[model samples]
Target chain A: MSWLLTLLAPILGGFLYGIERKLTARMQSRKGPPILQPFFDLFKLADKRPMVVHSYHAFMGIIHFVAAWVALSVLFFGGDLLVAIFFHLLSTSLLIVAGYSVKSTYSRLGATRELIAIAALEPILILTAISFYLHTGSFEVSKILTAPTSIFTSVLGFLALLIALPGLLKKSPFDAAEAHQEIVGGVEIEFSGFFYDTVYAAKWLDMLFVFTLVFLFGGSSFVVGGALAVFAFFVVLLADNSTARVRYCDMVRLLYSLAFVLAGANIILGVVL
Target chain B: MKKTIHIPIGSQHISLLEPVRFSFECENETIIKVEADVGYVHRGVELACTTKFKFKQVGYVVARVCGLCAIVHSTCYTLGIEELMGIEVPKRASYLRLIANELDRIHSHLLCLSHTAENAGYEALFMRIMKDRELVMEVQEAMTGNRIQFDYVSIGGVNKDMNSELEGVIRNKLGLLHQKVAEIKELFDNNWSLSLKYKNVGVITKEMAYRSSLLGPIARASGVNFDVRNDSDYLPYSELGFKSITMEGGDIHSRNMVRLFELFESIRLIETALDGMPEGEIAAKVRGTPEGESYMRVEAPRGECFYYLKASKGQYLDRVRIKTPTFGSVPGMIEALKGSNYADVPAIIASFDPCLSCTAR
Candidate 1:
């Protein structure tokens, strides 16, 4: 189970990324590609000779991917839960900085939005974990498992996390970073073939990151965790399909303001109730 | 104190699916000047046509210029060619072509309306409009094999014949389309915010519309009282009794309303054309060459699609000059944006349903 969790980030991340494309296609009334489309896309990209626009991009992409990988591995191996979350958050921030390094206005604008969304949602995520710590007396996933999971405090924290998931999923209303409707591919616009391929893989891994966050509430039961994760994925998809994207400024105000209130409520509830 | 402000919107903007640069000069939020620099997605297909393909192959290539208005370009090209050859398409085939063109117009107009709603941050309305358009797209797929670039119209006649099964499918789908459009029209007509944003944002007066020689709904919105179908007596339009849809405002709101109203008129035309279906060969035989120049005009989704064909003794034409409706509306776009705000630029530009492919090609 431990080893499986360690591999879960990439495998699930890759899988979820593939699913996002399929979901997008379906929303467009197209018959999307098969489930393994992301892997095929990656393989196709890998076969192409790596052409670097900037020498630092190749390294930055690797670092970003590695950061996300380490974070996912920590979460999978039942390491410090807060540490895993922090690393995942760090991966996106580093990736944004890398995205900003490109002079392409498309990527720069996208990175700016990505940074905003991350800043907006990060506190809520941290607060959710903090609430869990307040109840369970530790910041580690192993301690979370051993603690009484039935506390009202944990559920409130879970709800706060759930509320933040859509922002993390980058679904409509919160899809400012990679606003395809406006900025094309955003930070990933100039990346083509292999460089884009790595970023694309990173994006999928990001989805898996959210899925794993949902699965954390599952508390080691494989069936419950897997089912809940899938349900959450579909829920996000439904939300994406139903809503037209909001503007970046509007999205920031909505997501951050809602998150602040929700996190504040969670903290108060965790302490009082 | 007046200060010149240059605001660049789109080469890769979020509001549009394709990229085109617009330089909007503003005093505060009010737009004073607008200049559009198109040709970001130009594939140079027109130049390729002159060098690569034969006369027969050019029609298909021209249709590929725009994914949205494929039928309009193909039909305009073929109509010009047929006139050059002095061969008239059969009555039923012409009517069927009209049906395809009108169906395309409905779907394209719906897409623009939906995009307007989307850009204005009205998602529920956008989704409702899109879902309704899906039914129309289904009808299109049933008629033409594909949805976007329909390879239906060919020189002299259409490529495929619509049998009773296809006709029945079209009728049933059109009936459903009527109901859906009615609901959508109600949604647009009743919305106050939509009215506030669109009503008089881009107003082109009657003289300006005619002076600019604008075609299609853009001219009609300005009370031009011009429709090629009614005036030119081209295709099945001559056979079918067509009514000119004219509006007085010539504003963005009126343009949108004219398009919406025209969709219903197109549905009516398709029904009339289908009911009066004739029995004849869909295609006409064209072997020999034509003599002089021929000028043909058709009502496209945007406006008048003008094709001037000069034929020689050779198999291929001497020269083909197509003045798409969008090219004519460029002046009108600049005119509309003169006193408008910067925020209204997207909505105003979108109101034209500008086909850069058609214009550049």
Candidate 2:
């Protein structure tokens, strides 16, 4: 059961992304590819031999993919919440390094923006994790399920997850790094073939990682988790269709504003209730 | 000892949706110096023109320079050749050319403005402008038989004729478009933050703009009252009494405002030309090709796009030299970026509307 859940998290995340992309295309008034198109894209990319520009870029590629997978696997194991957050941060850090190693100005600027975005949202994420630990008296996901409380108050933590939602999808208004139509893939411009595929899957896995974090706030039930994950995916897709990308400076400013307001509200609620 | 800072902007570049490189030396946020290296465009059609084409074929070759502004390129080149050959285009042909060029201008300017707004973090404004641009594109496709690369202009005149029905459709659409453009203009003018981002940012002095030999809006923004249409009286432009709109401040805001105002000027030119519909043939057949060195200049979407052609006794031309408006403004742009903050780099670049393909070609 544990192994199945671990596999299912990434698979579900990847599947949702494929669906989201198709939905975005439809909203743009074009006939999009099949929902399984990303699977086919992954298969095609994997079949090609991975080419490296510098050996370190390839190393970052491996680290980014593996770290995200390991982070989500930690969630699946019902292990330490702090440990999963660290691994997720590790994956993002690796991506930043990869972006910096490229000679393109677009990639460098994008990496800089990604770093700023992380700075804006990481504090709120830590606060949400602490809120979970305070409510359940454990940092482990397996232990948090037994606490007696309705799903509504837990919605506070989910709102924190929602606040960081744009970062996870990397879609419009927050797509500072890989703005495909704008910067022509930004940090990932130099990435191609199998290495590109790894980064692509890692992106999907990162989405899964955050959605899994959202599901935890809802509870540990598989049915509720799956339903909430679907809900999160649709919300992100809607944003992608409706919004054009905001500049990195604007994105950071918005994130900070929302984080302080929502996270501060949650902190006050913890004091009163 | 002084350390020289080497920064590369693009080569597998993502920003600007095109490949262009800039190496700049900056002390803190102030740029000490800058150099533009633009050779990413690899289409060698001009060299191919020496063998695979005739004087008549030059229009098609010029149009291939860019997909988006193909009609502008073709019309400019054809107009230049026609002028050199002393062939007066029919009245209707000139009017049709003006209509096509102005419509192209609307789409091109809207596209640049939308991208500029997007880069500046103005999502709502960008979408609104882009939607308006789509209306112009739909009109273009309906009239020209293609969305882009209109191929409307030939050696002597235009290929397609605008009938009464097509004219009625375009006129009605233009009325709606004028209202939309007014709304967009109001939106930009009223936005305080947008003014802050643009006003006094990327300041290019009159002396600097002139020294760099800047043309079009970049030059006009600096208060240079020069337009190729006024200089040569090409097409229906001279007949319509086209206004050469300009501004004093040569900053990013002025550049944007000049373009914004020119959008209205273009519409006015089209409306006047369409109402005064001249009756005649759209094209004429050219027999002898005895052309010496002749040059022509026209205002492209960016600014003045120049084409110099030398024709031989036979079918192909001896040589074709192009000076895109973007290339002329490169020195001006680098000069403007001298002391602006690092955050304003993308916006400054967008303001110049540097079409790399045009520059590289």
For model 2, the local distance difference test gives 0.77
Listed for each candidate, the true contacts retained, as a fraction, are: 0.19, 0.10
The 10 consecutive residues of candidate 1 chain A with the worst lDDT sum are: A147-156
Candidate number achieving the greatest lDDT relative to the actual structure: 2
lDDT of 1 by residue, B115-176 (tens): 77766545556767888898889999988888888989988888788899999899998899
Please state the CAPRI-style docking class of candidate 2: incorrect
Alpha-carbon local distance difference test for all models: 0.76, 0.77
Per-model DockQ against the true two-chain complex? 0.12, 0.13
TM-score of each: 0.73, 0.80
Alpha-carbon deviation at B163 in model 1, angstroms: 6.4
Q: For residues B1-361, could you state the per-residue lDDT of candidate 2 as single tens digits? A: 5554344556544346578887677554346777888789968877876778777877898898877677778987887787668787887888888899889988988888877776654555666688788888988998898898898888787889888898888888888888998887776677655675677889988888778888888899999887787787666677788889889999877888888899888888888888788888988776566477778778888888888888766677888888888888888888888776555667788888888888787
TM-scores computed on chain B for all candidates: 0.94, 0.95
- Indicate the DockQ of the complex predicted as candidate 1: 0.12
Candidate 1 per-residue C-alpha lDDT over A18-108 given as tens digits, one digit per residue, 9 for 90 to 100: 7777786776566789889878888998888876768786667777888878887776676887898889888888778778887765576
